[model samples]
Target: MLGKILRIIGIILMGLASALMILGGIGTVCIAWFPENWESLAMMAPYKLIFQTAVIFTILAGILGFWATIKLARRKPNGWNMAVIALLLSLATAGTKMYFSNMARGSVAPTNMRFYFSLFVLLYFLALRIPAIWDKIRFEGDQPDEGVGGLAGGAAAIVAGGLTLTVHLWAGPSHTVNGINYVAYLQTELLAAGVGLIIVGLIPLALDLWKTAVSRHTSETLKIPVIDNRA
Candidate 1:
């Protein structure tokens, strides 16, 4: 019963995030590229590239997230894993924008908020993925999970972690404001988180490898000829 409720909540969150990303992307493109007042936008020309790139990533994440969530709601295979990757990328992409916003204002509060929000989202998603909760949400008639085979989940984690790492690389550890190198404290926080996620991502790979090895051993054992002594 509790699992069912959590599943619904997760779906709601995904839908909300998806809608926000889509609307945000459209608004960004229109405001940054096709502005009503050309002169005002021109004044911000230096940031046009950044805005465009951010919007692209936002839209991509929104689309993937929407698809993944929909699949999960339908009890499709790999949906959970895909959603994990999508959510991570979406969080990282959104965080990058927030970081820049905080930088422009010369305040670190927004970035910190973004990081905290990210941690909450990640924790919530993971809670739902716990085996006990995950199994409870499934109906008896639903297709059996062929298991993740570890590869899909592992790959998703790697992609998500890699994106997080990339964001850290692009943002760097500090931003120069008023000729002072102001270290964005969240930069280090994100870097450490990214590394940890990468390590976590390896679990799927290891699981898959172990499963494969066990399967092969079983197959080889079965292939051995039976002794004729019983006959």
Candidate 2:
């Protein structure tokens, strides 16, 4: 079970991290280079470069997180340490962006997906270190099928994709930029979240299906050795 859980985590982090890296990089570049053209971005004109650097760090942290997850799947000794670093970096990035963005926009609260997921995953790691919980998780660690995780991961990806899209649709195209730029509605965070989920979900889900198919094919085609005892 632990093994399968590790694999699922690996699949989820790698795919999500890859997607975030691409999107975050592009967004940072766009914000820095074309702040004037965007109403929301324009607000950060003075701090465009700052936000860009923060975003870059976030992307780097995500990459490290991906590497850490891979190491964990392989049962590397330093996997947890590396994960600690990645999660801290991610938390720092989230805090920095939220703090500065809120100050700039005159908002008291601001949040991002990175903030929520990193914090939760990190907390989970801490909880696992407890002897009692670790016992349960490791009870059937050596058992096969451990397949509950794979199914859960797939179902979660689908559900996340569906919910995000639903919210995006429900929100409609009507975003407000400090009482201005109605056009920002077309480019809302919900829209980005929905699209990101769809794209990110495709990676792990496709890989899961592909592996299942190959495994089935190999099982069907493989020949077993047989011997006959004759008098």
**Candidate 2, overall lDDT?**
0.58
lDDT of 2 at 112: 59
Q: How close is candidate 1 to the true structure, as a TM-score?
A: 0.51
C-alpha RMSD by candidate, in order: 13.6, 6.7
lDDT of each residue in 164-221, candidate 1, tens digit only: 5555343333333344433343457556755775786688678768888999999998
* Candidate 2 clashes between residue pairs 3 or more apart in a chain or in different chains: none
Q: Pick the TM-score winner.
A: 2
lDDT of 2 by residue, 1-231 (tens): 564564455445443433343344444455456679766667868877777787787778767875665555444556666777877877777777777777776642223555666677777667666776555443223455334444544544454555545542332222234666343443576467766766765666577788889999999889687777784
How far does residue 34 in candidate 1 sit from its true spot (Å)?
Answer: 5.1
Instruction: Count residue pairs with overlapping backbones in model 2.
Output: 0
Clashes of each: 0, 0
Top of the candidates by lDDT: 2
